[model samples]
Target: MDPKVITYYFADDGRIPNHPSLPLILYPGALKEKSDRIESIFNENNWRNSWTNGVFDYHHYHSNAHEVLGVQSGSATLQAGGEQGTALSVQAGDVIVLPAGTGHKRLNASPDFKVVGAYPNGMNYNLRRGEIGERPQALEEIGKVPLPETDPVYGTEGPLIELWKHKERD
Candidate 1:
């Protein structure tokens, strides 16, 4: 099925300089009851280093890698971008693609809320909570991240590939 895609952009928030070539991409009800399928899709597209869990309850971002989170069960309200970011309501089968340096947090969640998360190229990630001291290193690392060769859910072509490539040209 062609999933509904939504995108969000954030400016440099002093602490977290959200990516210029990437935006937060959300695919609602993309996984549905098939949330377990996320691993296979992510793996096939080179998004390795998988984990199953819920999002953090506090604001944070990763500078070392881009991340993809597939909602396996339950629902939650998530804050993305930064302090001035937008809040999103997510449920089972939903998927969120976070570019390196994009901040995110779990504002609230259902008891059964769970997610499958992974990174492109099996990248190891470091968490930063918008600390002023973390800005320099985070910015450097974020700038070094390469665009993924494939979309986490849509293989080599999809909204992610199309949008990110277009952003690069702008």
Candidate 2:
């Protein structure tokens, strides 16, 4: 069955410098079985350099590449976009794809909460804390960051490719 997808667009909130066009993608219960092999699945789709860990309590974002995080176990409430963004509750088997420059932070999680994260094309990632004097560069890099050729969860054609239409940025 095709996975159900939910999309969210975050504005440039000054501090976070969220992506202007791409909406964050969510796939609830997308990896119901074999959640333990999320990293392998991601790598298979060309989203590489996988890592397993818990989300940071403090808000942070990547400016160099898009990110995909799959819930390996347990559950958590993750704050997305920025301080003004929404609080999303995710659980095991859920997948979240964040475009470059989107802010995210962990509000709370279960004791065993763990997630597997990967980047498109094994792109090198850079961490940003929505600090002062970071918006200009972050925005620039975000615009130049290319879209992934395949969805981390679905491969060549999926909700990601359909929803993330490339747009020209100023």
Candidate 3:
């Protein structure tokens, strides 16, 4: 058996390049956690500033971009394939890493759930909107993998609540 290989490269101040997703999920403010350097293998490299809030929301992964969500406070579940796909539970100080081409969403189990993540190779979060537009089959509703759950968290029928707006602050 071989051990996983790990390499370390330091960027002064530590930050990664930004890979913006098309059609933009959440809002600018919600995604405004910001970065400083690019980790040879991570997203939003430095974790000094953070993107957080008290709300229930969902997101999908980019075509070739995976994500790492580490819970620093409260807890939540990463639900894939609608309501019965894969349910990964997480609590304070726990880490959940989703590989590239994986699609999933989060359920805010607490009034205030916060997480810090590190993504290597910056973010291509997903292929361009044009790319998805090219593939109607892939773009046809995420969560069809049918995550296995009867009434998992964030699994209900109702109006999606509003959280943040797409406004920028200077």
Error of 3 at 55 (Å): 8.4
Alpha-carbon runs more than 4 Å astray in model 2: 166-170
User: Which model is ahead, 2 or 3, in terms of lDDT?
Assistant: 2
Return the TM-score for each candidate structure.
0.94, 0.96, 0.42
Query: What tens-digit string does per-residue lDDT give for candidate 3 at 3-48?
Result: 1211111111111111211111211121222211112112223211
Model 2 TM-score, 2 decimals? 0.96
What does candidate 3 score in Cα RMSD to the true structure?
A: 18.0
Per-candidate Cα lDDT values, in order, are 0.88, 0.92, 0.33
RMSD to native, candidate 1 = 1.6
> What are the per-residue Cα lDDT tens digits for candidate 2 across 1-170?
57799999888787898888889999999997979889999999999988999999988999999999999999999999999999999999999999999999999999999999999999999999999888778888988999899999889977898888665554
Cα displacement (angstroms), candidate 2, residue 26, comes to 0.4
Candidate 3 ranges beyond 4 A from true positions: 1-56, 81-83, 127-170
Q: Name the candidate that leads on lDDT.
A: 2
Better of 1 and 2 by lDDT: 2
